[model samples]
Target: MAETVQAATLRADVAIIGAGPAGLFAAFECGMLRLGTVLIDALDETGGQCAALYPEKPIYDIPAHPAIEAGALVAALEQQIAPFAVPRLLGRRIERLQGSRGAFSLGTDHGDSIHARAVIIAAGAGAFGPNRPPLPGLAAYEQTGSVQYYVRRKEAFHGKRLVIAGGGDSAIDWALELREIALHITLIHRRAKFRAAPERLAQLEAASGPGGPIELVVPYQLHALHGDGGTLASVEVATLEGDRRRIEADHLLAFFGLSTDLGPVSQWGLQSALHHIQVAPSTCETSLPGVFAIGDVATYPGKLKLILQGFSEGAMAAHAIHPIVHPHTALHFEYSTSKGAPGSRDAPGSLAGAGHAPRPAAA
Candidate 1:
């Protein structure tokens, strides 16, 4: 006889899927609207791709700030929503969604369930995995912990020999960033031309010049791996012309970008196109009532995939959801200055520490 497993259940006014920037901001919006929200994400942490893929990279287009690192933006967003204290269910993938608007149930693979009045799909590009290179025995090496798909910490590679594979922003960025800590860094790419930013490429060139700690092994691909006890000892490389060489290294970092899929969200029967959910531009509502999509996962004509745009969409979805969640109450739009967040009576007419005065209603 098999053991019977009991599922954990939770309830909230709104169940938000995905813990990316859009979803985080949605929690803040929902909180301001006095809606209880529970956020679910497949990743172990928030920030989605920004935190997972390029935490150290710089972002310029985010409004109000001249420049900010990708990770810093995520931190700021997290701090902004700290007052909400939104419940986060991480490291669990939503396996099934049942019921309809005003009453929905979400079940995760971990046997945890959530019952919510509304659902928001803010999953950016859905569930994503690393794109591994076609290196023989790569899986075996991965089992030994010598192969890494993502750089979780730079200091971990300190004083160690590393061979980074790929030509994209992640590969180039890590190669450049890790050069300072690693004993020696070798950037391996199949093509001489890189998909990294022009400025990054220039920096890499300058750093790799003369007696720099970095070496460029371009126009080459991984040919073989030599190791024992499941741990990688070194890697073999070959050029398109068939010339081969061996590069001794203790570890390999492959950042070939991500392989994304809609995952269980695709089985929800929502109208979708090319893996993205189709949503109304005005309300960010999906084909199903009481369900909304925002951020990179939501698509429509003239939709610009930007963080700022996703922030606006989250606010719109929150306002549209207000009527459904609180049927008896009419929503009155007020600036943060006019109606501060809850529990800020001491700082009336302001959002806590935000010193801006309330703007006149006519203005």
Candidate 2:
């Protein structure tokens, strides 16, 4: 659930620039501290890539849970932040970021403005898109859904022959996932060694044996596509040794990872490198005071690009922003179990009573 913002200029103590897992968790953390917050994202939903791209994908690294789908994890986060009744400005991109420290003004692409005392940037990979393979007639197949970069719906490929390409976890995991539903699968990679976890690699190796559902093709790179009228028939592969082979396939799923850009965020005057914002590890604060970055968009000396790490970063960012929002009050850190969660918009420590923005709706 999300609250719509109809005001010309919305105000909050903290403005979160991405409503992904990290941003969502940051809202909860800020609410826990009694700081009014507003969630903003280009996408019209709270979950970001988890809900948009790989909702069906299973995440194994989340703490406590053995395995949970990406969408389910997002839902749990939504539930965690529901009590705050946080207002969300979705489907709007923050284009211009001006002002500083205790006073910041953000202009969105939708011509709306957000006034905040502090900002937390949790934009994971910023604006991201899949890295597509350079193959002839690729656009035709892509238009026909024969060549796909995201597996949003697994049932659509049921009983269909698939050519899964890449060496990373996305390729290997999808190969293993679709093996049960796909009629046959050909896993192609330029390297024999895959970049997945040891356990997943072992599973892939076991599933690629003779008479198995998956056939592992090593040292092979995609060369061409043999198809007509946006319909795929077979895929051509080649080795550096000049050896070429053609494998029959109905569709091609290329998971070569994502090509990400920081977009307008790079021009915000914050220290950045390789499309990532530099932030202090302890406070998740960027070079500019009152501005912070977390999740995959933030980088430091040693940063692990994991969702679990993003959650921790969000807490650090929220705690750091607390003093800026309430400089007169001393923050006495306490466990959540002791403080308990805020119940409603009018509850003690809720956003409504914080005297920042009006309550839009219950999230």
Per-model RMSD to reference: 7.5, 2.8
The TM-score, computed over Cα atoms with residue i paired to residue i, of candidate 2 is: 0.92
Expressed as tens digits, the lDDT of each residue in 40-120 for candidate 2 is 888878798999888999998999999999999999999988777788888888899999999998888898788889999
- For each candidate, the alpha-carbon lDDT, in order, equals 0.83, 0.88
Deviation (Å) of 215 in candidate 2: 0.7
Per-residue lDDT tens digits for candidate 1, residues 156-205, read 78899999988898888888888889999999999889897899999999
Model 2 worst lDDT window (10 residues): 354-363
How close is every model to the real structure, measured as TM-score?
Answer: 0.85, 0.92
